[model samples]
Target: MPRIKTILMAGTALASVLVLTPSPAAAQSTTKPKAEEQQEAETSTAKADRETLLDTITISATMINEAVFDSLSATSYVGDKDLERIQANTPADIFKTTPGVGASMNGDDPATAINIRGLQQYGRVVVTLDGARQDYWRVGHGSGSFYIEPDLLKAVTVIRGPVSNAYGSGGIGGLVAFETKDAGDFLNADEQYAISEKIAYESNGEGFTTSTTAAIRPHQAFDIIGNVNWRDRDAYEDGHGDEVRWTGEEVTSGYGKATFRPAQGHEIKLGAIIQRYEDYVTGSSGSTSATLSRYDADTINNTYTAKYTYFDPDDRLLDYAFTAYHNKTKAEQTQVWPTSSIGNFRYYDVRTTGISGHNSSRFDWMGLAHTLTYGGDYYYLEGESSASHFGQGEAQAYGGFLQWMGHYSSWLELIAAIRYDGYHLDGETKGTTTTPPEDESLDGDQVSPRFTVGVTPFTGFQLFGGYSEGYRAPGLQDVFRGSGAHDTADGYIPNFGLKPEVAKSWEGGVNLKYDGILTESDILRGKFTGFYTKVYDYIETDFTITPRMTDNIGTARLQGVEAELIYDLGWGFINLTGALIDAELIDTDNPKYKGQPLENAPLDKFSATVGFRAFEDQLIFGGQYLAVGEVKRTQRSSGTNPGQVDGPAQYSDAFELVNLFANWIVSENLKIDLAVENLFDVAYTDPQSAWSYTSDVEQGKGRTFKIGVTTRFGG
Candidate 1:
């Protein structure tokens, strides 16, 4: 295992160093050259675009806008061009090359759960779309899951670790924000109206997709955009030519937005999104046992948002934004198998309403530049389920935060922030044949703090370190929903004493940026981070005691190193990303469980991409290589359950994958894309998947080819 980690890190470093070495053309110039000379020598527009992207400003990390290359925390930004380059089909595809991030979903379902570092589930990782939070969960094999249409996204921003606690409460793990396309993204500078249509096909699942977008700028003060998409797919075969059951699905989604500028310094925007999914799933949705059930399922997700912002170029005292949003997710299922359970119907529904506002003030104080920001947010959530043991409750959470950023001269920077979070939960425990239902309630509050400092001793280089704290309140289900045979020997017991989880993290990293490093028209940029996090009062299920129920487990420790590097020359570019992590639970009462690797932890992985631009940067081609490490599960005896030892420890073998993608701009109004996924067609299963059973492993798709065409018309 140590050798593997060494190899992964060494390979990434070697590749980057080799790419940074000067070429024959660059070596011919012995003296320093002018910036204009370098710009004039650039022939590929893609190179310039890449440099600009590296400077893209992001607001997810510290709530203060700054470029990803300069942010003190680990941050990543994915723009529309990056999405198009990868030909993303699902949300997981968008982060395939990002370090310290993992996404898992069942082959038969479209819902996805994201993991950051070794933490997941129950608000650990905050996910939002257009400022509306997505907090839907069920007692299933996987953790909390969310549904979204990737085709509707214009950009995505991710901040890893609790350093982003100021973004919202319960984001002890991190934050993932998705921004949808607007009218300005579709309409041309001189056009009053525009329309775009796209069609795509995939060979593996025999999938088909059609999307249409229309935008209208009726006047200088107002604009609107609308989009609709439909997709369908059949079950695809695995690498071994075997059909994976219940993999087919049909989906329909729509998005619309309107923007108005009421005055010179005031703007208002409203947006809505809706998605529907239909599919067949086979499994015990609430259990991890091998026994399964079959069902026909239909799901719908909807979100609505309104935002107002006021910013005046002449006023340095105030920059304000206020937003309100609502989201709802509902899933209906009907049983199909087992004569006794036939005709049974189940449903799960969740609704969330929230409002948030913030303002920033900039000024010069005592020979230093300073920015002060303050914000507050509140959300109300309600969930109802037809199933006996599923979540059925209501929860409300709110928080207020203040942050300050200061700069001294050109080399020293400092940031400090603090937040107060509170939550209230209420629900009723299900009644059995011999017992009546009972109402339950719980409440908690806490305060967290963060501080950071950065130094630049030389040009194009920076060193930064920080310490941050985050808090996560217990979920409604964690305090309610106890059900069983009504006997202490065979049922679940509610633990009203369950405590919230708190995370304290320490991180240090370095940032590197250089223009004209190896060539007059070349650029190199990179970020490397090392983080250690200790979670107190970690929550988990305690099966060792009778009447199994959730409880606050012992402390957990997780540490990892992540690296991302990008090198772009005139004609081509290279990207490398990798992460190695170690995680374990400590001070557990159960001796057998102590020091064991977390079941939800992801394996070490590395990715590399190399691409070339031709025909005046109108055509692009690229290929990606991915390698994932193996995972081993240790065996443990099932306490109190005699004659039934827990299933043998399972081993998930390591795997390798290859992919190729290409895009062509045949004309200003037409574009084409082609790609091949799983190029090697190796039979393998992702180690991060939660659906794997002792006897069955969910296999990934086999070799597949995809093609897409898009056209635009405007007037």
Candidate 2:
């Protein structure tokens, strides 16, 4: 066990060092201010040009949004135009085409899990929606993001490694934030009252996908947006297209948003969201049409938010953002119990309300550019779970964060961030608190810090190094899961006391850009980057094989690497990306199978994609390929994984697949698109539970297709 754990830690450390290094230009941007610092951006923000691989995107790689790149250890951006090109139904779809990115089903569920640096799902990677921290812990999906309609999004930025201080905790890998539509540039001029709408429908036969969005910005001060979605799929098939018999899901959602800027340097936004998912599940082996799955759950997520922002006097570099919101998540799940007569059930109702405020100030100190950001947040969540026993859990978390950025010219930059968070949980089980010896109240606090330096010597060339620490507070289930839910352990049980897990990671990488690099005639633009991260308290869970009780087996170590590359030649574009992760339990201090791969961590995974566009951008085409490495599972005292760890460790052998898609212009007012997933159908099982031994996971959708169209009236 010790040896295996050591390898996991060592592998991760090495990966962190091997990720692409930073460049000279990035270093300068961090430490110094340029002469034309507040100059109008001429880097191409044209809406009619249709942004492609050749365009450069400016991001808040540091505390303040800037035009500089290569100032951070790992980060990637997807623009509005790019989102349209993908014709995606969900946010997860975009990850599929991004380099060094991975997206898979959490199970046979609608909540598709996303991974970066091989660490994701749960709250490992912080996800912010329009700057609001969205915790994935409300149960279903169990990640940082919920089901947000894709069309309403304007951009998605991924800080692929632990290099920022924008989170309170659980940013072990990095962070991904989704920014909804904001039309500052789109409606900046009086004559710019034009509308861009999209309506798309897609179906691979595995199910049907459809969505429509309406956005209007009659003036720069206000933008109104709304979206709707519907999906349905019958039982899916295997790689051979033969019906797998009994796997299906149905979902529908609607949303609305409004942004208002009544005065200069100030803005306010409000939004409403609602979604419900229903599953008509049929078990794997076709047992009684619906009795097979140990997990048959239906969930709903409803949210509302109001936000305000203040820009500096010049709106040139300084900004402050504040937001407050409320969200509710509820679910009911059926568990197949041991006794035929006794049916087991699990239900949870969770409500969360919180407020967050961030203030960032940017200025030029002497010849150097300086930006400082600080913020704090508070959230109270009330939840209840029921089974053989019902338990109510209330947890409140509060924290503050700070970040400082120093630029030494456009070639070098530095940043430091720190955050402290405290959590308290007070609650009791339904019947006898004394039976489980309920302590009644638990309190803990964690501190996380990050440091990064970036250097950029030339345009599009960057090098960066970063150090960061992250942690996750124990969830209600981790410390309170009962015996009836257990399958492989000694009758299910729960531990009232559990500690938070932590990780300290460091990464150094280089970023390269190719635009007008090879020849003046070349229109291709490309970027390549690599990174690594290491965690100390890589949290893990244990279950008894016979009784099915969950246990926290202390802490472990985890490490992984990530890489992405893309190229565009006007005529076509190509992208390649991959991830490698290694994890194991350390100091198990137990005799039950000492050395084994940590549950749910795949040793290696990667993907490849290519896209083409016809003359005048009237036609578009693309395809994708993916790979999932084999995994090793440990024997179980207990686990939700139906297959014992010893069994094949369920080698979800790596497989290859292809996807094809296209878009055609119908007229000035309308357009059409066609997308096919799994063009060359490949049989593959994606890992789901953190406890699953065999990884008898969700199967990839076989041959799905979608057709969609959009039309618009005068703005």
On TM-score, the leading prediction is 1
Runs in model 1 with CA error above 4 Å? 1-4, 11-47, 284-291, 483-489, 634-647, 694-698
lDDT of 2 by residue, 536-555 (tens): 44444454233444455544
How many pairs collide in each candidate, listed in order? 0, 78
Assess candidate 2 and give its lDDT.
0.59
Candidate 1, poorest ten consecutive residues by summed lDDT: 636-645
Q: Residue-wise lDDT of candidate 1 within 1-715, one digit each (tens)?
A: 4544775678566645744565555567555568756656464354567778777876756677778889999998888888888777678888878888888776777788888888877788999999899988766554347888888999889899998887777999899898999899889899999999999999988999999999999997999999999999998877876766677899999999999998999989999999999987665332334346677889999999999999897888889889999999998989876667778898889899999989989999898899899999999999888875665789999999999999999898899999999999988766778989788788999999999999998776789999999999988667675642122466676788989999999999988777776666677788889999998888876655667777886888889998888878858888888889887788777665578676667568888889998998899899999888887764432434521213466787788799999999999899999999999887777767665454243467889899999999999
CA displacement after TM-score superposition, residue 392 of candidate 2 (Å) = 4.2
lDDT computed for candidate 1? 0.82
CA displacement after TM-score superposition, residue 484 of candidate 2 (Å): 4.9
